[model samples]
Target: MHIPGFDTTTIGVADGIELTTAMGGTGSPVVLLHGFPQTHLMWRHVAPILAERHTVICPDLRGYGASSKPPATGPDTYAKRTMAADITALADVLGLGRFALVGHDRGAHVAFRAGLDFPDRIDRLGILDIVPTLDTWNVLHGVDAAVAFHLYLMAQPPGLPERMIAASADEFFGHFLDIWSASPAAIPPDVRAEYLRACRDAVPSIVADYRATATVDIDHDRADLAAGRRLTMPVTVLQQDWGSALGFDAAAVWRPWAPDLHHSLTRAGHFMAEEAPADTAAAILDLLDR
Candidate 1:
Protein backbone atom coordinates (compact mmCIF):
# COMPACT_ATOMS: atom_id res chain seq x y z
CA MET A 1 0.00 0.00 0.00
CA HIS A 2 1.19 3.53 -0.76
CA ILE A 3 2.01 5.35 2.43
CA PRO A 4 -0.32 8.39 2.45
CA GLY A 5 2.09 11.27 2.02
CA PHE A 6 4.81 10.36 -0.52
CA ASP A 7 5.41 8.78 -3.91
CA THR A 8 6.70 5.17 -3.68
CA THR A 9 9.34 3.21 -5.63
CA THR A 10 11.29 -0.03 -5.29
CA ILE A 11 15.05 -0.55 -5.62
CA GLY A 12 16.68 -3.95 -6.14
CA VAL A 13 20.15 -4.16 -4.63
CA ALA A 14 22.57 -7.03 -3.94
CA ASP A 15 21.50 -10.39 -2.47
CA GLY A 16 18.22 -9.73 -4.29
CA ILE A 17 17.14 -7.41 -1.49
CA GLU A 18 14.27 -5.39 -2.91
CA LEU A 19 13.70 -2.29 -0.77
CA THR A 20 10.46 -0.35 -0.86
CA THR A 21 11.13 3.40 -0.77
CA ALA A 22 8.89 6.47 -0.63
CA MET A 23 10.55 9.31 -2.56
CA GLY A 24 9.38 12.79 -3.40
CA GLY A 25 10.37 16.45 -4.14
CA THR A 26 14.02 17.49 -4.57
CA GLY A 27 17.26 19.17 -3.36
CA SER A 28 19.70 17.86 -0.75
CA PRO A 29 18.91 14.20 -0.02
CA VAL A 30 17.51 13.43 3.42
CA VAL A 31 17.21 9.75 4.35
CA LEU A 32 14.68 8.87 7.06
CA LEU A 33 14.75 5.59 8.99
CA HIS A 34 11.92 4.18 11.07
CA GLY A 35 12.00 2.42 14.40
CA PHE A 36 11.23 -1.25 15.09
CA PRO A 37 7.69 -2.74 14.83
CA GLN A 38 7.15 -0.25 12.00
CA THR A 39 8.07 0.43 8.40
CA HIS A 40 9.21 3.31 6.14
CA LEU A 41 5.56 4.35 6.30
CA MET A 42 6.27 5.58 9.81
CA TRP A 43 7.61 8.70 8.12
CA ARG A 44 4.44 9.26 6.10
CA HIS A 45 3.55 12.44 7.94
CA VAL A 46 7.04 13.92 8.06
CA ALA A 47 8.65 12.98 4.72
CA PRO A 48 6.42 14.81 2.27
CA ILE A 49 6.56 17.96 4.35
CA LEU A 50 10.34 17.85 4.03
CA ALA A 51 10.09 16.52 0.48
CA GLU A 52 8.73 19.85 -0.78
CA ARG A 53 12.17 21.29 -0.01
CA HIS A 54 14.46 18.26 -0.04
CA THR A 55 14.74 14.87 -1.69
CA VAL A 56 13.11 12.71 0.96
CA ILE A 57 14.04 9.02 0.66
CA CYS A 58 12.39 6.77 3.23
CA PRO A 59 13.05 3.04 2.73
CA ASP A 60 11.87 -0.08 4.51
CA LEU A 61 15.01 -1.27 6.21
CA ARG A 62 15.81 -4.92 5.41
CA GLY A 63 13.49 -7.49 6.97
CA TYR A 64 10.79 -4.92 7.68
CA GLY A 65 7.56 -4.20 5.79
CA ALA A 66 7.90 -4.76 2.06
CA SER A 67 11.70 -4.99 2.24
CA SER A 68 13.39 -8.31 1.55
CA LYS A 69 13.66 -10.51 4.65
CA PRO A 70 16.30 -13.08 3.84
CA PRO A 71 16.92 -15.92 6.28
CA ALA A 72 19.50 -15.06 8.91
CA THR A 73 23.07 -15.68 7.66
CA GLY A 74 24.31 -16.18 11.23
CA PRO A 75 24.48 -13.76 14.19
CA ASP A 76 26.76 -11.41 12.20
CA THR A 77 24.25 -10.73 9.42
CA TYR A 78 21.82 -9.16 11.88
CA ALA A 79 24.42 -6.80 13.36
CA LYS A 80 23.92 -3.03 13.11
CA ARG A 81 27.02 -2.75 10.89
CA THR A 82 25.43 -5.13 8.38
CA MET A 83 22.15 -3.17 8.52
CA ALA A 84 24.04 0.13 8.15
CA ALA A 85 25.79 -1.32 5.14
CA ASP A 86 22.38 -1.75 3.50
CA ILE A 87 21.70 1.98 3.94
CA THR A 88 24.99 2.88 2.28
CA ALA A 89 24.24 0.38 -0.45
CA LEU A 90 20.83 1.96 -0.96
CA ALA A 91 22.44 5.39 -1.30
CA ASP A 92 24.92 3.94 -3.78
CA VAL A 93 22.15 2.26 -5.78
CA LEU A 94 20.34 5.58 -5.98
CA GLY A 95 23.54 7.48 -6.85
CA LEU A 96 23.41 9.57 -3.67
CA GLY A 97 27.03 9.98 -2.61
CA ARG A 98 26.11 12.12 0.41
CA PHE A 99 22.95 12.69 2.43
CA ALA A 100 21.53 13.67 5.80
CA LEU A 101 20.39 10.75 8.02
CA VAL A 102 17.58 10.55 10.58
CA GLY A 103 16.55 7.41 12.45
CA HIS A 104 14.48 6.43 15.48
CA ASP A 105 14.54 3.40 17.81
CA ARG A 106 15.98 0.42 15.86
CA GLY A 107 16.74 2.62 12.89
CA ALA A 108 18.56 5.09 15.17
CA HIS A 109 20.79 2.24 16.30
CA VAL A 110 21.73 1.59 12.66
CA ALA A 111 22.14 5.33 11.98
CA PHE A 112 24.64 5.77 14.80
CA ARG A 113 26.72 2.91 13.41
CA ALA A 114 26.40 4.33 9.89
CA GLY A 115 27.66 7.73 11.04
CA LEU A 116 30.67 6.15 12.72
CA ASP A 117 31.48 3.77 9.83
CA PHE A 118 30.87 6.24 6.97
CA PRO A 119 31.36 9.66 8.56
CA ASP A 120 32.56 11.19 5.29
CA ARG A 121 29.34 10.35 3.50
CA ILE A 122 26.88 11.59 6.15
CA ASP A 123 26.58 15.36 6.61
CA ARG A 124 24.51 15.42 9.81
CA LEU A 125 22.86 12.84 12.04
CA GLY A 126 19.59 12.88 14.00
CA ILE A 127 19.01 9.96 16.36
CA LEU A 128 15.58 10.02 17.95
CA ASP A 129 14.98 8.77 21.50
CA ILE A 130 17.98 6.46 21.88
CA VAL A 131 21.42 6.29 23.46
CA PRO A 132 24.43 4.32 22.22
CA THR A 133 23.98 0.51 22.26
CA LEU A 134 26.55 0.02 25.01
CA ASP A 135 25.04 2.81 27.07
CA THR A 136 21.57 1.21 26.92
CA TRP A 137 22.90 -2.25 27.84
CA ASN A 138 25.10 -0.87 30.60
CA VAL A 139 22.28 1.18 32.12
CA LEU A 140 19.37 -1.26 32.24
CA HIS A 141 18.56 -3.00 35.57
CA GLY A 142 15.51 -3.44 37.89
CA VAL A 143 12.63 -1.11 36.90
CA ASP A 144 14.54 0.02 33.82
CA ALA A 145 14.83 -3.64 32.89
CA ALA A 146 11.09 -4.05 33.28
CA VAL A 147 10.45 -1.18 30.84
CA ALA A 148 12.68 -2.92 28.29
CA PHE A 149 11.45 -6.52 28.56
CA HIS A 150 11.64 -6.88 24.79
CA LEU A 151 15.44 -6.56 24.95
CA TYR A 152 15.93 -9.57 27.20
CA LEU A 153 13.00 -11.50 25.72
CA MET A 154 14.19 -11.29 22.13
CA ALA A 155 17.76 -12.15 23.09
CA GLN A 156 16.52 -15.61 24.00
CA PRO A 157 17.07 -18.74 21.80
CA PRO A 158 14.82 -17.80 18.85
CA GLY A 159 11.26 -18.95 17.79
CA LEU A 160 9.83 -18.23 21.25
CA PRO A 161 9.34 -14.43 21.16
CA GLU A 162 8.23 -14.58 17.54
CA ARG A 163 5.61 -17.24 18.22
CA MET A 164 4.43 -15.58 21.41
CA ILE A 165 4.22 -12.17 19.74
CA ALA A 166 2.49 -13.50 16.64
CA ALA A 167 -0.27 -14.86 18.87
CA SER A 168 -1.71 -11.39 19.57
CA ALA A 169 0.25 -9.13 17.26
CA ASP A 170 -2.11 -6.18 17.56
CA GLU A 171 -2.17 -6.21 21.33
CA PHE A 172 1.59 -6.69 21.52
CA PHE A 173 2.45 -3.80 19.21
CA GLY A 174 -0.65 -1.67 19.77
CA HIS A 175 -0.06 -1.54 23.52
CA PHE A 176 2.96 0.69 22.96
CA LEU A 177 1.26 2.60 20.16
CA ASP A 178 -1.47 3.46 22.65
CA ILE A 179 0.47 4.00 25.88
CA TRP A 180 3.83 5.36 24.65
CA SER A 181 2.30 8.57 23.44
CA ALA A 182 0.77 11.47 25.34
CA SER A 183 -2.13 11.28 22.90
CA PRO A 184 -3.99 8.08 22.06
CA ALA A 185 -5.87 9.57 19.13
CA ALA A 186 -2.78 10.52 17.17
CA ILE A 187 -2.65 7.34 15.11
CA PRO A 188 -5.81 6.39 13.21
CA PRO A 189 -7.16 2.84 13.02
CA ASP A 190 -5.84 1.97 9.53
CA VAL A 191 -2.35 3.22 10.35
CA ARG A 192 -2.37 1.27 13.59
CA ALA A 193 -3.41 -1.92 11.71
CA GLU A 194 -0.65 -1.42 9.15
CA TYR A 195 1.94 -1.07 11.89
CA LEU A 196 0.66 -4.20 13.65
CA ARG A 197 0.76 -6.21 10.41
CA ALA A 198 4.32 -5.11 9.70
CA CYS A 199 5.33 -5.99 13.24
CA ARG A 200 3.79 -9.46 12.87
CA ASP A 201 5.53 -10.15 9.56
CA ALA A 202 8.96 -8.94 10.74
CA VAL A 203 8.93 -10.69 14.13
CA PRO A 204 11.81 -13.08 13.39
CA SER A 205 14.07 -10.40 11.95
CA ILE A 206 13.16 -8.14 14.84
CA VAL A 207 14.18 -10.87 17.26
CA ALA A 208 17.46 -11.30 15.41
CA ASP A 209 17.97 -7.53 15.43
CA TYR A 210 17.62 -7.35 19.21
CA ARG A 211 19.67 -10.53 19.69
CA ALA A 212 22.58 -8.91 17.81
CA THR A 213 22.43 -6.07 20.33
CA ALA A 214 23.31 -8.46 23.16
CA THR A 215 26.23 -9.88 21.18
CA VAL A 216 27.97 -8.32 18.14
CA ASP A 217 26.51 -4.84 18.74
CA ILE A 218 27.95 -4.67 22.24
CA ASP A 219 31.39 -5.63 20.95
CA HIS A 220 31.20 -2.89 18.30
CA ASP A 221 30.10 -0.25 20.82
CA ARG A 222 32.75 -1.26 23.35
CA ALA A 223 35.42 -1.02 20.63
CA ASP A 224 34.20 2.46 19.71
CA LEU A 225 34.23 3.45 23.36
CA ALA A 226 37.77 2.18 23.71
CA ALA A 227 38.81 4.15 20.61
CA GLY A 228 37.08 7.32 21.97
CA ARG A 229 35.19 7.64 18.67
CA ARG A 230 32.33 10.16 19.04
CA LEU A 231 29.94 11.40 16.40
CA THR A 232 31.65 13.94 14.11
CA MET A 233 28.50 15.54 12.68
CA PRO A 234 26.09 17.91 14.42
CA VAL A 235 23.55 15.68 16.22
CA THR A 236 20.00 16.23 17.45
CA VAL A 237 18.23 13.94 19.94
CA LEU A 238 14.53 13.93 20.90
CA GLN A 239 13.64 11.81 23.91
CA GLN A 240 11.20 11.69 26.78
CA ASP A 241 12.79 13.00 29.99
CA TRP A 242 13.11 9.59 31.58
CA GLY A 243 14.51 11.15 34.73
CA SER A 244 11.35 10.25 36.62
CA ALA A 245 11.67 6.68 35.43
CA LEU A 246 15.16 5.71 34.19
CA GLY A 247 16.82 8.08 36.71
CA PHE A 248 19.70 9.54 34.67
CA ASP A 249 20.58 12.75 32.87
CA ALA A 250 19.64 11.79 29.29
CA ALA A 251 21.32 14.75 27.59
CA ALA A 252 24.48 14.67 29.67
CA VAL A 253 25.00 11.02 28.72
CA TRP A 254 24.77 11.90 25.00
CA ARG A 255 27.29 14.81 25.26
CA PRO A 256 30.35 12.52 25.32
CA TRP A 257 29.14 10.68 22.23
CA ALA A 258 27.75 13.67 20.32
CA PRO A 259 30.05 16.69 20.44
CA ASP A 260 27.26 19.10 19.41
CA LEU A 261 23.92 17.79 20.68
CA HIS A 262 20.45 19.29 20.59
CA HIS A 263 18.38 17.49 23.20
CA SER A 264 14.70 18.07 23.82
CA LEU A 265 12.12 16.39 26.08
CA THR A 266 9.22 15.53 23.84
CA ARG A 267 5.74 14.79 25.21
CA ALA A 268 5.30 11.63 23.17
CA GLY A 269 6.36 8.12 24.12
CA HIS A 270 8.48 5.77 21.95
CA PHE A 271 6.42 6.17 18.78
CA MET A 272 7.17 9.87 18.56
CA ALA A 273 6.82 9.97 14.78
CA GLU A 274 3.18 8.91 14.78
CA GLU A 275 2.26 10.48 18.11
CA ALA A 276 3.73 13.88 17.46
CA PRO A 277 4.55 14.21 13.75
CA ALA A 278 4.24 17.99 13.79
CA ASP A 279 6.76 18.27 16.58
CA THR A 280 8.81 15.42 15.14
CA ALA A 281 8.86 16.92 11.66
CA ALA A 282 9.66 20.35 13.08
CA ALA A 283 12.58 18.93 15.04
CA ILE A 284 13.89 17.19 11.89
CA LEU A 285 13.51 20.37 9.83
CA ASP A 286 15.23 22.38 12.56
CA LEU A 287 18.14 19.95 12.47
CA LEU A 288 18.27 20.14 8.69
CA ASP A 289 18.73 23.91 8.92
CA ARG A 290 21.37 23.57 11.61
Candidate 2:
Protein backbone atom coordinates (compact mmCIF):
# COMPACT_ATOMS: atom_id res chain seq x y z
CA MET A 1 0.00 0.00 0.00
CA HIS A 2 2.86 2.34 -0.80
CA ILE A 3 2.34 5.68 -2.45
CA PRO A 4 3.14 5.28 -6.18
CA GLY A 5 6.47 6.78 -7.30
CA PHE A 6 7.54 7.06 -3.69
CA ASP A 7 10.40 5.16 -2.11
CA THR A 8 9.68 3.41 1.17
CA THR A 9 12.23 2.80 3.92
CA THR A 10 12.50 2.15 7.63
CA ILE A 11 14.54 4.75 9.50
CA GLY A 12 15.44 4.49 13.17
CA VAL A 13 14.37 7.70 14.87
CA ALA A 14 14.56 7.60 18.68
CA ASP A 15 13.91 5.03 21.42
CA GLY A 16 15.06 2.44 18.88
CA ILE A 17 11.70 2.81 17.16
CA GLU A 18 12.12 2.79 13.40
CA LEU A 19 9.43 4.43 11.27
CA THR A 20 8.38 3.10 7.90
CA THR A 21 8.32 6.15 5.61
CA ALA A 22 7.35 6.76 2.01
CA MET A 23 9.21 9.63 0.43
CA GLY A 24 9.17 11.34 -2.98
CA GLY A 25 9.86 14.60 -4.84
CA THR A 26 13.02 16.73 -4.82
CA GLY A 27 12.85 20.18 -3.35
CA SER A 28 12.24 21.62 0.11
CA PRO A 29 11.07 18.85 2.42
CA VAL A 30 7.51 18.50 3.73
CA VAL A 31 6.70 15.63 6.08
CA LEU A 32 3.16 14.27 6.33
CA LEU A 33 2.14 12.20 9.32
CA HIS A 34 -0.75 9.77 9.14
CA GLY A 35 -3.48 9.46 11.77
CA PHE A 36 -4.79 6.49 13.70
CA PRO A 37 -5.87 3.28 11.98
CA GLN A 38 -4.03 4.37 8.83
CA THR A 39 -0.53 4.71 7.47
CA HIS A 40 1.58 6.73 5.07
CA LEU A 41 -0.64 5.39 2.32
CA MET A 42 -3.29 8.00 3.22
CA TRP A 43 -1.16 10.53 1.41
CA ARG A 44 -1.06 8.58 -1.87
CA HIS A 45 -3.18 11.07 -3.79
CA VAL A 46 -2.06 14.24 -2.00
CA ALA A 47 1.68 13.53 -1.82
CA PRO A 48 2.27 13.39 -5.57
CA ILE A 49 0.87 16.86 -5.97
CA LEU A 50 3.05 18.25 -3.19
CA ALA A 51 5.94 16.22 -4.61
CA GLU A 52 5.82 18.32 -7.75
CA ARG A 53 7.19 21.28 -5.81
CA HIS A 54 8.51 19.82 -2.57
CA THR A 55 9.94 16.59 -1.27
CA VAL A 56 7.13 14.91 0.69
CA ILE A 57 7.87 12.44 3.48
CA CYS A 58 4.95 10.47 4.83
CA PRO A 59 5.46 8.15 7.78
CA ASP A 60 3.33 5.84 9.86
CA LEU A 61 3.50 7.11 13.44
CA ARG A 62 5.66 4.77 15.57
CA GLY A 63 2.90 2.64 16.97
CA TYR A 64 1.08 1.96 13.74
CA GLY A 65 1.71 0.45 10.29
CA ALA A 66 5.15 -0.97 9.51
CA SER A 67 6.85 1.20 12.14
CA SER A 68 8.54 -0.41 15.13
CA LYS A 69 6.15 -0.68 18.07
CA PRO A 70 8.00 -0.83 21.34
CA PRO A 71 5.82 -1.77 24.31
CA ALA A 72 4.68 1.25 26.31
CA THR A 73 7.19 0.72 29.08
CA GLY A 74 6.55 4.15 30.59
CA PRO A 75 4.10 7.04 30.46
CA ASP A 76 6.19 8.95 27.93
CA THR A 77 6.77 6.18 25.40
CA TYR A 78 3.77 6.95 23.20
CA ALA A 79 3.32 10.55 24.23
CA LYS A 80 2.85 13.07 21.41
CA ARG A 81 6.02 14.78 22.63
CA THR A 82 7.95 11.56 22.12
CA MET A 83 6.34 11.07 18.72
CA ALA A 84 7.19 14.67 17.90
CA ALA A 85 10.84 14.07 18.74
CA ASP A 86 10.88 11.20 16.29
CA ILE A 87 10.07 13.68 13.50
CA THR A 88 12.93 15.94 14.57
CA ALA A 89 15.35 13.02 14.63
CA LEU A 90 14.08 11.89 11.26
CA ALA A 91 14.70 15.34 9.81
CA ASP A 92 18.23 15.27 11.26
CA VAL A 93 18.86 11.86 9.74
CA LEU A 94 17.54 13.01 6.38
CA GLY A 95 19.73 16.16 6.48
CA LEU A 96 16.73 18.45 6.56
CA GLY A 97 17.75 21.35 8.76
CA ARG A 98 14.17 22.54 8.62
CA PHE A 99 11.00 21.20 7.02
CA ALA A 100 7.29 21.89 6.72
CA LEU A 101 5.03 19.41 8.54
CA VAL A 102 1.40 18.41 8.15
CA GLY A 103 -0.65 15.77 9.93
CA HIS A 104 -4.20 14.52 10.23
CA ASP A 105 -6.16 13.30 13.27
CA ARG A 106 -3.81 11.72 15.82
CA GLY A 107 -0.83 12.76 13.77
CA ALA A 108 -1.96 16.39 13.97
CA HIS A 109 -1.42 16.22 17.72
CA VAL A 110 2.18 15.18 17.07
CA ALA A 111 2.66 17.99 14.57
CA PHE A 112 1.33 20.52 17.07
CA ARG A 113 3.80 19.28 19.65
CA ALA A 114 6.68 19.36 17.16
CA GLY A 115 5.91 22.92 16.18
CA LEU A 116 6.20 23.88 19.83
CA ASP A 117 9.18 21.68 20.72
CA PHE A 118 11.23 22.26 17.56
CA PRO A 119 10.21 25.58 16.11
CA ASP A 120 13.60 25.98 14.46
CA ARG A 121 13.29 22.64 12.72
CA ILE A 122 9.62 22.84 11.79
CA ASP A 123 9.36 25.63 9.22
CA ARG A 124 5.60 25.41 8.89
CA LEU A 125 2.78 23.44 10.50
CA GLY A 126 -0.45 22.15 8.99
CA ILE A 127 -3.12 20.33 11.00
CA LEU A 128 -6.17 18.47 9.80
CA ASP A 129 -9.36 17.81 11.76
CA ILE A 130 -8.11 18.23 15.34
CA VAL A 131 -7.63 20.67 18.18
CA PRO A 132 -4.74 20.62 20.64
CA THR A 133 -4.78 17.78 23.19
CA LEU A 134 -5.53 19.99 26.18
CA ASP A 135 -8.25 21.84 24.33
CA THR A 136 -9.75 18.56 23.17
CA TRP A 137 -10.26 17.39 26.73
CA ASN A 138 -11.45 20.80 27.82
CA VAL A 139 -14.05 21.13 25.06
CA LEU A 140 -15.75 17.78 25.29
CA HIS A 141 -18.59 17.72 27.79
CA GLY A 142 -21.64 15.71 28.73
CA VAL A 143 -23.29 13.84 25.88
CA ASP A 144 -21.25 15.59 23.18
CA ALA A 145 -18.15 13.79 24.36
CA ALA A 146 -19.73 10.62 23.14
CA VAL A 147 -18.59 11.61 19.67
CA ALA A 148 -15.13 10.62 20.80
CA PHE A 149 -15.97 7.57 22.84
CA HIS A 150 -12.80 5.87 21.70
CA LEU A 151 -10.71 8.53 23.40
CA TYR A 152 -12.26 7.72 26.78
CA LEU A 153 -12.13 4.01 26.02
CA MET A 154 -8.41 4.08 25.30
CA ALA A 155 -7.68 6.49 28.14
CA GLN A 156 -8.45 3.81 30.67
CA PRO A 157 -5.56 1.89 32.23
CA PRO A 158 -3.88 -0.59 29.90
CA GLY A 159 -5.33 -4.10 29.92
CA LEU A 160 -8.96 -3.28 29.20
CA PRO A 161 -8.55 -1.12 26.05
CA GLU A 162 -6.08 -3.53 24.46
CA ARG A 163 -8.32 -6.47 25.15
CA MET A 164 -11.55 -4.75 24.10
CA ILE A 165 -10.23 -3.34 20.81
CA ALA A 166 -8.30 -6.47 19.87
CA ALA A 167 -11.36 -8.60 20.50
CA SER A 168 -13.15 -6.86 17.62
CA ALA A 169 -10.36 -5.01 15.86
CA ASP A 170 -11.82 -4.78 12.40
CA GLU A 171 -15.23 -3.75 13.62
CA PHE A 172 -13.68 -1.17 15.92
CA PHE A 173 -11.32 0.33 13.36
CA GLY A 174 -13.72 0.02 10.48
CA HIS A 175 -16.33 1.96 12.41
CA PHE A 176 -14.29 5.15 12.17
CA LEU A 177 -13.45 4.53 8.51
CA ASP A 178 -17.13 4.20 7.81
CA ILE A 179 -18.54 6.97 9.99
CA TRP A 180 -15.91 9.69 9.57
CA SER A 181 -15.77 9.81 5.80
CA ALA A 182 -18.52 11.84 4.17
CA SER A 183 -17.63 10.38 0.81
CA PRO A 184 -17.18 6.66 1.28
CA ALA A 185 -15.83 6.23 -2.23
CA ALA A 186 -12.73 8.24 -1.34
CA ILE A 187 -11.33 5.21 0.47
CA PRO A 188 -11.57 2.40 -1.99
CA PRO A 189 -11.88 -1.15 -0.80
CA ASP A 190 -8.17 -1.94 -0.80
CA VAL A 191 -7.00 1.06 1.20
CA ARG A 192 -9.67 0.55 3.83
CA ALA A 193 -8.69 -3.10 4.19
CA GLU A 194 -5.05 -2.14 4.63
CA TYR A 195 -5.96 0.32 7.41
CA LEU A 196 -8.01 -2.29 9.21
CA ARG A 197 -5.26 -4.89 8.97
CA ALA A 198 -2.64 -2.46 10.23
CA CYS A 199 -4.83 -1.47 13.17
CA ARG A 200 -5.81 -5.03 14.02
CA ASP A 201 -2.20 -6.08 14.32
CA ALA A 202 -1.12 -3.03 16.32
CA VAL A 203 -3.79 -2.85 19.03
CA PRO A 204 -1.54 -2.59 22.10
CA SER A 205 0.69 0.08 20.64
CA ILE A 206 -2.30 1.98 19.30
CA VAL A 207 -4.01 1.88 22.68
CA ALA A 208 -0.84 3.08 24.34
CA ASP A 209 -0.60 5.93 21.85
CA TYR A 210 -4.13 7.03 22.71
CA ARG A 211 -3.65 6.47 26.42
CA ALA A 212 -0.79 8.96 26.44
CA THR A 213 -3.14 11.67 25.22
CA ALA A 214 -5.00 11.35 28.52
CA THR A 215 -1.86 11.34 30.65
CA VAL A 216 1.63 12.63 29.84
CA ASP A 217 0.56 14.39 26.64
CA ILE A 218 -1.84 16.61 28.58
CA ASP A 219 0.85 17.48 31.11
CA HIS A 220 3.17 18.53 28.30
CA ASP A 221 0.50 20.67 26.69
CA ARG A 222 -0.34 22.29 30.02
CA ALA A 223 3.32 23.12 30.65
CA ASP A 224 3.62 24.70 27.23
CA LEU A 225 0.45 26.69 27.72
CA ALA A 226 1.59 27.89 31.11
CA ALA A 227 4.95 28.94 29.72
CA GLY A 228 3.20 30.95 26.97
CA ARG A 229 4.86 28.77 24.36
CA ARG A 230 3.23 29.09 20.96
CA LEU A 231 3.94 27.80 17.52
CA THR A 232 6.26 30.39 15.95
CA MET A 233 5.95 28.93 12.48
CA PRO A 234 3.15 29.57 10.01
CA VAL A 235 0.25 27.27 10.85
CA THR A 236 -2.65 26.06 8.77
CA VAL A 237 -5.57 24.06 10.15
CA LEU A 238 -8.19 22.41 7.97
CA GLN A 239 -11.19 20.79 9.56
CA GLN A 240 -14.63 19.43 8.92
CA ASP A 241 -17.29 21.62 10.59
CA TRP A 242 -17.18 19.63 13.78
CA GLY A 243 -16.70 22.68 15.95
CA SER A 244 -20.06 24.09 14.98
CA ALA A 245 -21.78 20.88 15.93
CA LEU A 246 -19.62 20.23 18.95
CA GLY A 247 -20.10 23.79 20.27
CA PHE A 248 -16.66 25.37 20.09
CA ASP A 249 -15.14 28.03 17.91
CA ALA A 250 -12.46 26.06 16.11
CA ALA A 251 -10.41 29.05 15.07
CA ALA A 252 -10.65 30.56 18.52
CA VAL A 253 -9.42 27.36 20.08
CA TRP A 254 -6.38 27.34 17.78
CA ARG A 255 -5.61 31.08 17.74
CA PRO A 256 -3.92 31.24 21.13
CA TRP A 257 -1.49 28.45 20.26
CA ALA A 258 -0.91 29.57 16.70
CA PRO A 259 -0.81 33.36 16.51
CA ASP A 260 0.10 33.10 12.86
CA LEU A 261 -2.74 30.79 11.97
CA HIS A 262 -4.93 30.25 8.95
CA HIS A 263 -7.94 28.11 9.79
CA SER A 264 -10.59 26.94 7.34
CA LEU A 265 -13.42 24.45 7.27
CA THR A 266 -13.47 21.74 4.62
CA ARG A 267 -16.29 19.93 2.95
CA ALA A 268 -14.37 16.71 3.10
CA GLY A 269 -14.53 14.25 5.94
CA HIS A 270 -12.00 13.67 8.73
CA PHE A 271 -9.68 12.04 6.17
CA MET A 272 -9.32 15.15 4.06
CA ALA A 273 -6.09 14.10 2.39
CA GLU A 274 -7.71 11.06 0.84
CA GLU A 275 -11.23 12.41 0.43
CA ALA A 276 -10.16 15.69 -1.14
CA PRO A 277 -6.58 15.42 -2.28
CA ALA A 278 -6.41 18.39 -4.60
CA ASP A 279 -7.84 20.72 -2.02
CA THR A 280 -5.63 19.26 0.71
CA ALA A 281 -2.55 19.71 -1.45
CA ALA A 282 -3.55 23.26 -2.20
CA ALA A 283 -3.85 23.97 1.54
CA ILE A 284 -0.33 22.60 2.13
CA LEU A 285 1.03 24.66 -0.74
CA ASP A 286 -0.70 27.70 0.66
CA LEU A 287 0.80 27.00 4.07
CA LEU A 288 4.26 26.65 2.56
CA ASP A 289 3.82 29.89 0.66
CA ARG A 290 2.95 31.62 3.94
lDDT score for candidate 2 against the true structure: 0.93
lDDT of 2 by residue, 124-207 (tens): 999999999999999999999999999999999989899989999999999999999999999999999999999988999999
Q: Candidates' TM-scores?
A: 0.95, 0.99
On lDDT, the candidate that comes out on top is: 2
Predicted candidate 1 versus true structure: per-residue lDDT over 97-158, tens digit per residue: 98999999999999999998889888889989888898897678786678788788888877
> Residue 17: error of model 1 in Å?
1.7
Cα distance off (Å), candidate 1, residue 97: 1.2
72 Cα displacement, candidate 2 (Å) = 0.3
lDDT of model number 1: 0.85
